[model samples]
Target: MSDHTIPHIGAAWREVVADLFEMTKPKVVLVMLITVWVGMALTPIGAIPWLAVIAGNIGIAALAGAGAAFNHILDEHIDQKMARTHKRPVATGRISRRAGLSFAGFLSVFGFSVLMIFTNALTAWLTLFSMVGYALVYTAYLKRATPQNIVIGGLAGAMPPLLGWTAITGHVMGLPLLLVLIIFAWTPPHFWALAIHRRDDYARAKIPMMPVTHGIAFTRIQVWLYSWLLLSVSMLPVALGALGGIYALSALLLGARFLQWSYWLLYEKKPDAPWGMFKYSISYLMILFIMMLVDHFTWSWLVSIIFPNI
Candidate 1:
């Protein structure tokens, strides 16, 4: 090949590779991984196994990526119709359906295998179930079916914490469920804020997002309500004694800010309010989980320092 032709081919190959990576929705996968790590960290397993934790995290990331890829494939038509998603790899035909499917299949197999080998069968199966729940049940059916799609579909997305817990302990029980509940309660407000901002995009796609189906005014109220619900649910860890004062304080402060943003979204006339709330919600969850990890490690020391008599 000519030198110029070789350079052109190399650049084209790089673009394709980048597009493939984009189809995996790396940002979402990253957030999920953080929750997974926090879940594993909070588990009371003595003499933690760093190697298995690393491997388990890899497996969960792979599974989450595969689910995202499947979503890209399934939502191509809907994506092409929406302005924000019109340039997506599958939507724009930069990645073909066969290639996307093959990539997803490879990830699913690799992730499940990794979990089974390094974690345990329970974690592996639960991860697979979550993948299918998102890729098939949520993306394919629930998304197009109703205005309450996110509320219902949030379960699968909220499983990462529980998956993390099971990865280390090989069991699913109380604390993990509370962790899952926090994310579950947080999901509706988090997603609905974005849905409100992208109301027109979902309208154009003919997807029945809350703002499109229930109207933006009604959706804003729901966001406000769910924000309150999230605040309450987030405090449950402290109440149940799964977490302590540090995490409790973090949740209260973070949740108060989240509630304030949602209130602004509800009452304000500014177009940017919804997007602003959406961004804050992401930070809220991240910081909340990090605080959980911090409190998990430092609670006893902090309590001793503060309440020496007790």
Candidate 2:
């Protein structure tokens, strides 16, 4: 091939790689990884296994990416009809369904292998269940079946902390379960804000998202209610003595901001309020988990300094 043709071929390959990466929904995968880190970190393991932590996290990310790719294949038709998702790689035919499926299969096998080798059988199995939960159960059935789809489907997305904890301890524990509960309670408000923003797209696609099925006004009320619910659930860790004062204070402050945005979305009804809430919710969850880690590590040291006599 001529030099000019070689450059053109390289550019084409680059574009193809980018498209494949897009199918994995990297942004969502990133959030999953952060929660997983928090889960593993909060475990009471005496010595950290850095190698397993790194390898297992890579495995978890791969599985998450695989699930997202599967979602691209299954939701292509719905994605094509929705303005927000119409330009997705599968929907746009930039990557065919068969290619997407093969990619997902590869990721699933690779991720499961890595987890089993580096982590444990339990972690591997649990991660696989989460993949199936998201890719097959939620994407294929629940999403199209009911307006409460996200509520039920939220468990899959919320499983990373448990998976992370199990990777370290090879079993379930109360703290990890509490972490899962926080995410589960947070999902509705987080998603409903986006659904309200994209209500027209969902309506056009005939997807029964909360705003589409129940009306935006009703969905807004649900968002408001769920925000309070999230705040309440967030306190459970501290109440159970699993977390500390630092995390409790962080939760209250972060949750207050979430409630503030939710309040605006409900009463103020600014056209941009829903989008603002959607954006903030993402940051809120990430920061909340990071604070949990911070609190977990530093609380004893701080208490010792504050009350030297005690």
Separate clash counts for every candidate: 0, 0
Candidate 2 clashes between residue pairs 3 or more apart in a chain or in different chains: none
Model 2 CA deviation exceeding 4 Å by range: 300-310
lDDT of each: 0.92, 0.93
**Which digits, one per residue and each the tens of the lDDT, describe model 2 over residues 1-310?**
7879999999998988999999889999999899999999888777899977987898999999999999999999999998889999999999999988999999999999999998899999999999999999999999999999999999999999999999998999888999999999999899999999999999988889999988998999999999999999999999999898889999999999999999999996576999999999999999999999999879756877998877
Task: Supply candidate 1's per-residue lDDT for 74.
Answer: 99
TM-score of each: 0.95, 0.96
Residue range 130-209, candidate 1, lDDT tens digits: 99999999999999998888889999999999999999999998988998999999999999999999999999898899
Q: What is the lDDT of residue 139 in candidate 2?
A: 95
Whole-model alpha-carbon lDDT for candidate 1: 0.92
Residue 195 lDDT in candidate 2? 95
TM-score of 1: 0.95
- Candidate 2, position 96, lDDT: 91
